[model samples]
Target: MDNVRTDKWLWAARFFKTRSLATDAVDTGRVKLDGDRIKPARAVKVGDKLAIDNGSDAWEVVVLGISDKRGAAPVARALYEETEASIVKRENDSQARKIYREPASTIKGRPTKRDRRQLGKAGE
Candidate 1:
C-alpha cells in the first residue's frame, strides 16, 4: 500500500505492542506526523516523518516502507529509519538511567508498618 493509517503503521512497525496501544498513543498526542499531532486515522506515506513517545523511549523516524501486517522484528525495523539524533539521545538517556535511578523505583509494593515508621523517622 502507498499509505496506511498511522496507528496501523505504528503497530506494524512494532512501535507499540498492539494496534489499540498505538491508537491510544496517537489520540493522546504522543505520536506526531512531521511535528504535528495527528489523529490515529491519519494516513502515513513513505518519507513521512514521525515523532513518537512510547512511554519508555521516544523516536524520530522517517517512514521507509508501508505495510499493514505485523511481522517479525527485522521486517518491522525495516519499515522506518530512526534519526541519528534519536539514537544518540536514547543511548545517553540509557547511560544516565544506569548511573542514577529513581529511588522510588526500588520500593516493592506497599510499605509495611515498620517500613513506614522508619520513613517517618527519617523524615524527622
Candidate 2:
C-alpha cells in the first residue's frame, strides 16, 4: 500500500475538479479518513475508509490502492471500492427526487403572430 497524499487521492478518485479543490476540501474538513478529519498532506494507505461530504450527496469508500495522478474510469475503479448498498440508496433517492418534479405546462395551440406581438409582460 502506498502512503498517498490526501489531495492526490481525492484528485485521482475524481472527487474534486482539481488538486487545489481537493486540498481546500481537506482543509475545511469536508474530507475524512478512518473517522477523523485529515489534512491535504496526510498519508493514506490501502484499507483506509474515506468519508467525503460532497454537498448534494455524501460519499463513502474504502481505499484499495493509491495514485498521485488521476486515471481513467476503469483505473480509478481499482483505486477505491464503493458499497453496493450505497449505490442503490443514492440511485433510489435520485429517482424519488425526479418523480416529485413538476412537468412543464402544455398550451392548447400556437398563438397567431398578431397575438404574439400583442403579448407582453404586464408592469408589476
Candidate 3:
C-alpha cells in the first residue's frame, strides 16, 4: 500500500498491541506525525516521520512500508525504521530503569492479615 491509516500502521508495525490502543494513543496525543499531532485516521505514507510514546517506551521512526494487516514481528519491524537518536534514548532509559526501580513496584495487591497486624503494631 502507498499509505495506511495511522492507527492501522501503528498496529501493523507492532508499535501497539491492538488497533484500539493505537487509536487511543493517537487521540491522546501520544503519537505524532512529522512533529504534529494527528488523528488516528491520518494517512501514514512512506518516508513520513512519526513520534510515538506508548506509555513505557517512546519511539521516533520513519515509515518504510505500509500495511493494514498485523504480521509476524520480523514483518512488522520492516514497516518502519527507528531513528538513531530514538534508539540511543531508549537504551539510556533502559539503563536508568535497570539501575533504579520504582519503590512501589515491589508492593503487590492488598496486604495479608499478618502484614496488616505488623503495620498496626508499628503505628502504636
Tell me the tens digit of each residue's lDDT in model 1 across 1-124.
7868999999999999999999999999999888889999888999999999999999999999999999999999999999999999999999999998864566699988877787778669
Reference-based lDDT, each prediction: 0.93, 0.79, 0.91
lDDT computed for candidate 1: 0.93
Span of ten consecutive residues with least summed lDDT in model 3: 102-111
Model 2: how far residue 27 lies from native, Å: 1.5
Model 1, residue 124: C-alpha shift (Å)? 9.8
lDDT string, candidate 2, 3-111, tens digits: 7798988899888878998899899999988779888898978888888866666778888988988889889889888767667877887897688642222224686
Model 3 clashing residue pairs (backbone): none
Task: Pick the lDDT winner.
Answer: 1
| Top-down lDDT ranking | 1, 3, 2
- Distance from true position, residue 37, model 3, in Å? 0.6
In candidate 2, how many Å is residue 35 off?
2.2
Candidate 3, overall lDDT? 0.91
Q: 13 in model 2: Cα distance from truth in Å?
A: 1.2
How far out, in Å, is residue 56 in model 3? Answer: 1.0
TM-score, structure 1 vs. true: 0.89
lDDT of 3 at 93: 99
**C-alpha positional error of residue 27 in candidate 1 after TM-score superposition, expressed in Å:** 0.4
